[model samples]
Target: MTVRVLVVDDSLTMRNLISAALRQDPEIEVVGSAADPIEARAAIKTLNPDVLTLDVEMPNMNGLEFLEKIMRLRPMPVVMVSTLTAAGTDVTLAALEIGAVDAVPKPATATPEAFHDLIGKVKTAARSRVRARSDAPPREAAPQNYSPDPRHVLAIGSSTGGVEALLTVLGGFPANCPATVVTQHMPANFTASFAARLDRVCAPTVTEAVEGAPLEPGHIYIAPGGVAHLETTPGLTPRCHLSVGDPVNGHRPSVDVMFDSVARLKRPMTGVILTGMGKDGARGLLTMREAGARTLGQDEATSVVYGMPKAAFELGAVERQLPLHRLSSAILELCADPAVRSVA
Candidate 1:
């Protein structure tokens, strides 16, 4: 099936470049173009495009504000066109949290490599599952006075629909949670902003992993999305190791790389595979399971894209599968001290 797309950008050149690039693919059709949300809103009703390519900054209203309205009233798959700058990444991350399917950096010259990313994002957005804000109930809070086993580390992997899913799961973490590491596929320019966003929302002190950063409780390290793949140095006191290497599983900060590194660690672990678009985390989760780590995967019904978790589940990596709401409780339970009990 062909994916009909509407291009929304204030810049005429950007609109044409995006439309032309998308037109290169046989599976995607450029249905229309709109300069702003007002125009785009009208185009949506008339063109009824399957996918919408939205720009970050527009004339009248901010793209993020418009995106929030779209998700609340008329949830649809949207691909954000963002500039590669500090402010741009911040707004783009906000758009993702507001439920855009994906984001791509705007190009200076419309290079083939750049448009390749855009074309891929358009197709992926076309197939994404977007639910209205009203349809998504609030995620329950983490168990109160949760006590974690300091000897255990929590490793999580996600992509595609990960921003919202991670927020749902990590929002439930207690103040003093397990030493946690995550590898979420994202644009290189966007990771720092995303890490900052996570830090503000989640209870733990979240930061992008740097070389030699020690793995410890009450802290979450997110693999920096770039040339370096994050690894753990082997020892009683493990530290974050940023290994510059070829892309594994077609990603620099590949989930498999992080999981494999943790699998070699002496600490007990619980590996979780959440909503994503591919099989990057499957084999790694399997390795963790083989090493006696409890493995969990987000269930299909709760996943915006079921690819990663489904792959992990089929590979015998996942010991349990639960909906998004229940996943946090399960993780806390698996990582909890057996003797610690909290009253309801």
Candidate 2:
């Protein structure tokens, strides 16, 4: 199927560059172009493109503000074009909260290759269904837990396009959310960067898990990129287990490893398998479910690749499937009850 796209940016050079990159792929067609949000609004109405490539910083109601309006008025898939800078990162996160599908970091040089990558991301985002949550109450800046009882911990796993997905899910958390751990398949250098990115965007304190550190509510620990798996230890407090032992499901920081640990250490934990391209988390999520954990999977329509969640669903690991927009609220609803506590 041909994926139609609308490129929105103030820079004519950027607009041309993006258009050219997308045209190279036969599957992607540049339907229209807009200089700013105002023009983009009209273009979106006229062109009715399948996906939108939005710039983070633009004149006349910045990209983020415009994106909010678009989500409110006409929700669709949007991929953000973000600079690889601190401030740009912040704005990109805002875009995700406003219902952007994903973010591609723009290279400093802005070479042909950079725009080509952006085109690829746009195409991928276009294939995914990203709807806006118009009725859900606006999330607060603090980490909010759906359950107040502290009985259930949340163990999530993802890969490939996980950076943006993780941030979006965590950003919806309130200040007093449940203890959470994540395993996003990535290389050594990228995990730290990803964790730092989440720390900056998410309300909960996020950091790369260190050996022996206790898991705390409102704190999120990301596994390091090395050949180690994070497992929950005993004592009502969990410790990080970093090992070069072996790759589970062809992954060092395997989702199965984390999920299994949660099932063993915190039965009745909540298992969330987000967008990914592999089956690493499927088995582990099943174990969690069997252990009485509530399991949630990102629906196929909202997934970037749909491989992981599909596998988990086939394995009967998922008790519920939801889109990206509703995931946070669903998680909150599962955890917000003060009487809810983990059976583990």
Candidate 3:
């Protein structure tokens, strides 16, 4: 089925450019365009498009406010179009938490490749499931009997629908949970803001990974995007290392790079591959499993896109596949198990 799209942006040039790019995909149709939220509301009611491309900054009202209203009143798949500035990145991350399906940075100058990428995001967003603004799944309370091992490190990787997925999983962690590392596919400017948001909402402290930062319990480190791959160095003090290198699997700070580095460490580890569009982390997860680390993958039923987890499962890298809501509990259980810890 052809995906019907509504373009909402204050700039006529942007609307035209977005529309032109999406139209290049034979499966996508530009049904309408709107200059502001007022116009967008009307277009949404009449056109009832399959997907929406919303600009983060608009004339009458900002995109964030409008997005909240839409998600509350009528939940639907929405992709945010934002600039690459710091302020824009912050707002875009907020939009994702408010139930937007995904986001794309507005190109400074729309090139053929940029248009192709935009078109691909729109197509993926059209197929994604958008939950209602208030429809969060009930979280299980932290297990009273569980105590995490100080020597255990939890490493996670995700893409596409990861912002909310990571939020759901990490929000369930206890204040004194195990030390963790994450390599989510995000832009350079967005990682800091993303980490800040996670810090506020999660029980464990979260920060963007820094070079030589000591991996400590109860703190979570996120790999900085676009700059370097997050890796680990083995020694008396196992610390986070950022390495500048060519993009692996078409991504800098690739999940494979992080997982492979974690595999080299002497301490016990747990690897998780969550919802994403590609198979970037499959091989690395396999390496972790081969090194006696417990590995988990998010199951298809709960995944927005199952590509990464599916790849890991098929490769025999993931020992268990669980739904989104159950993953946090499973991680805690694995961490507390003496049998699992002995493999380290």
Which candidate's TM-score is highest? 1
Model 3, 213-266: lDDT tens per residue? 988878999999899999988876689999999999989889999999999997
TM-score of 2: 0.70
> Per-prediction RMSD in angstroms?
1.3, 5.5, 2.9
TM-score of each: 0.97, 0.70, 0.91
- Please give, for residues 58-132, the per-residue lDDT of candidate 1 as tens digits: 999878888998999889999999999999999888888889988888877765456778888778787778998
lDDT of each: 0.89, 0.78, 0.88
Better of 1 and 2 by lDDT: 1
Candidate 2 ranges with C-alpha deviation above 4 Å: 115-120, 137-153, 158-178, 183-212, 223-237, 241-257, 260-269, 275-280, 287-294, 298-308, 320-344
Clashes of each: 0, 19, 0
The alpha-carbon deviation from the true structure for residue 103 of candidate 2, after best TM-score superposition, in angstroms, is 0.4
Which of the predicted structures, 2 or 3, would earn the higher lDDT when compared with the native?
Answer: 3
Ranking by lDDT: 1, 3, 2
lDDT of 2 at 184: 88
